[model samples]
Target: MASKVTPISGFQEWLPRERIAEQYVLDTIREVFELHGFASVSTRAVEPVERLSDQGEDADKEIYAVSRLAGGDDEARLGLHFDLTVPFARYVLENSGKLTFPFRRYQIQPAWRGERPQRGRYREFIQADVDIIDAAELPGHYEAELLLVIADVFGRLPVGAYQVHVNNRKICEGFYRAIGIEDVIGTLRIVDKLDKIGEDGVASLLLAAGCSQEQADRCLALARIRTSDTSFVQQVRALGVSHPVLEEGLTHLASVMETAAEHAPGVAVADLRIARGLDYYTGTVYETMLERDPGYGSVCSGGRYDALASDGKRTYPGVGISIGVSRLLGLLIGEEGLTASRETPAAVLVAVNDEETRSDSIRIAAALRSRGVPTLVAPKAAKFGKQIQFADRRGIPYVWFPGAGERGGDAVKDIRSGDQVDADAASWTPPAADLHATLVTPGSSD
Candidate 1:
């Protein structure tokens, strides 16, 4: 019996044109990551449930446990990884003996989470992550360098006017300590909800969590400090708070902002309020926002984790960021109508002139394919108009007609403009722009 077909909530599926656009985005990201010297790595989908839940985040509720219906009692329990970082950490530990230190790698894979889905959020989504990890200690300069890597990737993409908001956990920790507040993580957890519940709501929660009215106000003040330059340091100092840890955090953040100014101008901002919510981030944290639609939440986010990857004998400290590919595409392709110029990769369709000469069309297609032109032969020997319509419906730009010229040579027609010209199968080439599908934004003229 045929079952009813229905779209599953939180699961994303794209049509052919949209899938082409997604492939273009993924290809651009992979190319840029490799160009920046990051090696690619892919880990398995499931890990020990204990490892997935060990991270000090509220991720346990979102974990999808994997099990077999006929499994024995001795079988180990496993769960799908909610994020790439955890599994990558496990991979590093398992292979530490063979891999070199100061390793830089990029992982692009899908992660499953059972959280409630909303705009730009999904149960199963693709994440592109880049990280640099080293034994014992990692340099602070990598925190700044990763920002430039993200900027470079977005520079080539059509995502317009985005900013990478940089913050340090030490700044929040030290500031909370200086103000006579205990339970720093608890306070951060509450403040992270500021976007959801307004300032009054956060203040109320802070007070209920045993914070004095004055302490709550000061926390709010700290969260409001945001700057595009090093001036954020001075502004933070003016708050009448001082601690050694606070000073250390300010210095580190200042260096990151200064380096970003020189390398990735107007791309990084020092936002003091961005407490990444994850307890593993011991230092610099990042959250990216598209200027066009900040309400869509962060399209990319990550931070430095000092103890995330570790065994008893060794610890790998690292910093990284993940691009929420599905989230970004949900807005660009699904909402704004961004798409590819064609549904298929084929740039030219070899039309079948007649049943007796179908082999000629196949040979022409083979010749074009050998020359790196995406070509396909028509399925049957249909009328000239019908064959042209087949190519048109698929957005194929050119159609090749065998033996259609006056001198018994092949002819190619620009289907869009209806301009036919005599051409040679051996040497003719499609224009560079038309050789493959190109991304088309909402307002741009193709």
Candidate 2:
């Protein structure tokens, strides 16, 4: 036997309750994506190495190469995908001929990264993503749509308040160029670290990139103006939008904010400073943060790219958002206050009256299942008390006890309130609320 168990760094597992929270996030993602007309699809976890090559050096390094035993070789060029977008782009390219234009998809799966994990960052994590790919140029309204849907996802969750940090690479670059900073693309790389390295570190890098203190401070100040409202448009104007590029960025942000507010009221806002650390995005970028928990950072973030994917013929301009499912679930589950109703699917467990009469219990279970209830039967003909304990452990609140005689055939118990009554197996109804899994209400303290 091995001397001890091995625990890998930067990876975590979920216990039952934690798994329930994770499942809740996944379920809500599917619901919201479908409600917005996005069809669901998933791509293989591994992809050709070239697929994710369009990312930054940091993102590229995070690609966890597949093991040699898994068909990887010195000549083989494939790695586990680090994010949903890259494989999605490849999926679109390889199957473009078959797919309809303006393809909308939602993917929920685990992604691997070889990174130094921190508070909410992980090496092996699950991401929930939704994207819209268009054959022609996608309007900025789609950008707002991406943020609106994702914001609504977390907004509906039990997590505390969150704001979608909105920005445009166009706006940031325009503002940079307008402010006379050369190599705007190179400068954005350094400034993206403002959250990690601090203003002083970014300023030093800006100086290294030949930005003057005035220009550096202005760029830093611009990145700092996040809002969930249209106030940033006014703020950017005060920053002097004389440069046409900065003005364009300003107008684009105003348009996105206006559309989001109208369609998904109060869901998005303009923050001139949301530099989405990726090079591909030429337009709007979004990052959502839990209002009171910056420690968890942006639970969802993505941006728009005009030409990130194309077949050298038609361009597929795209915009998307990804929610760090495992991370957000991690924050909510053991949060000392968050709660989920069920750990298993059984809404009601049918009690066994006697070992000789196991068929009676199975009959009762079928009755509940017919009523669209999830019912679990005892493994063996156990005592009534044993079945109740089993249901209680799994948090299956309602237990049905088969009656002794013909007229008194079915009786049920609500384990939570300890309420019991004789009712027919065919038509007896569990309380409306107890009929299905109950999601904890937002900001609930149970």
Candidate 3:
């Protein structure tokens, strides 16, 4: 039976050109991650439903439950993981004995969420995550290091003018407690909506959540504190609230900002309102925003979780940040028309002059490929113009015509400029820029 074709609202599928662009981004991320000494790891897509539900912040409501379509009875409940962190925690617990302490790993995978889809949100999406985990104790320096890692990745990509907003749960918890608000997590959950809901809205929600009007106003004031450097410590002090936890948070955040300034200046900001809604976050939290489009929401976010993974006798503490690959690409490729130099990786298409000499074309392609040039033979022996058109349509810059030169050797044409020159398949090389697919954005020179 023929199946009906339709576009799923939240499922993202890209064309050949867009896929090439995405692969370029993914490759860049993997390269940077490996260069920083993060080992790659992957976990199963489905986790136990109870495990998924146990994650805080209403995560259970968005979990996609999985059940056998044709099974007898007594099957365990399972669900597609909504995010990588939960599964990673479980992995740490299961492999605690086999793995070494202070493990540094990178995981790039797709996660499913059954929440409402929006401009940059999808039901299924790819998240590239880097985390450093240690048994019992994780260094505060790792929090600052993770920020630098993100900065390194963004610097290598075309993501323009972004900042990693850093905050600490201790900051929010201590501030709330100082103001006599007992439900720190619940209050943070409401305050996390400050961006979605304005100050007045958050105030109302806070008041409704058992906070006095004075307390709600104070919370809003704290959420509004944002600074580009360690000056935020003084600013928080000026709020006139004092607590041991708040003091501890201020010292930690200052160290993070100071280290970031020395290493990755202008890329880190101390934004107190970034209370990552997840309940697991115990200390540092991060949310990244592209200055060009802050309304697009955080393209990368994560934080420190001290007790998310514990096996009664031991605890694994870690810090991680996730880049929303699908969300970022959806904005760049789908909305802004970003793409790759060509649909295929081939930089030079070896033209097939005639069916009898097709073997010659294949041999030429092999020679060029052997020399590290991406080369492909034309599929059919058509007119030179038609063959060239095929290459042009796919953005293939150079096309090789066998026996077209005066010496009956070979000639390559730069389709963009209509320049053809005699060349040898064994020695000819495409320009470095043309060797692989290059990204083409709105402002790109290509």
Clash pairs detected, candidate 1? none
Candidate 2 lowest-lDDT run of ten: 437-446
In candidate 3 the C-alpha lDDT for residue 45 amounts to 97
**Preferred candidate (lDDT higher): 1 or 2:** 1
lDDT of 1 by residue, 9-33 (tens): 9988999999999999999999999
TM-score of each: 0.98, 0.92, 0.97
State the lDDT of candidate 2 residue by residue for 14-105, as single tens digits.
66655666676788888999999998888998887766756775777888766566453466677899888888888888888999988998
Ranked candidates, highest lDDT first: 1, 3, 2
Clashing pairs in 2: 223-273
For model 3, how does the per-residue alpha-carbon lDDT over 326-417 read when each residue is reduced to its tens digit?
99998889899999989999999999989998999999999998888988889989998999999999989999999988798899999999
Error of 1 at 290 (Å): 1.0
Q: What is the C-alpha RMSD of each candidate to the true structure, in Å?
A: 1.2, 2.5, 1.3
* Cα RMSD, model 2: 2.5
Model 3 per-residue lDDT at 269:
92
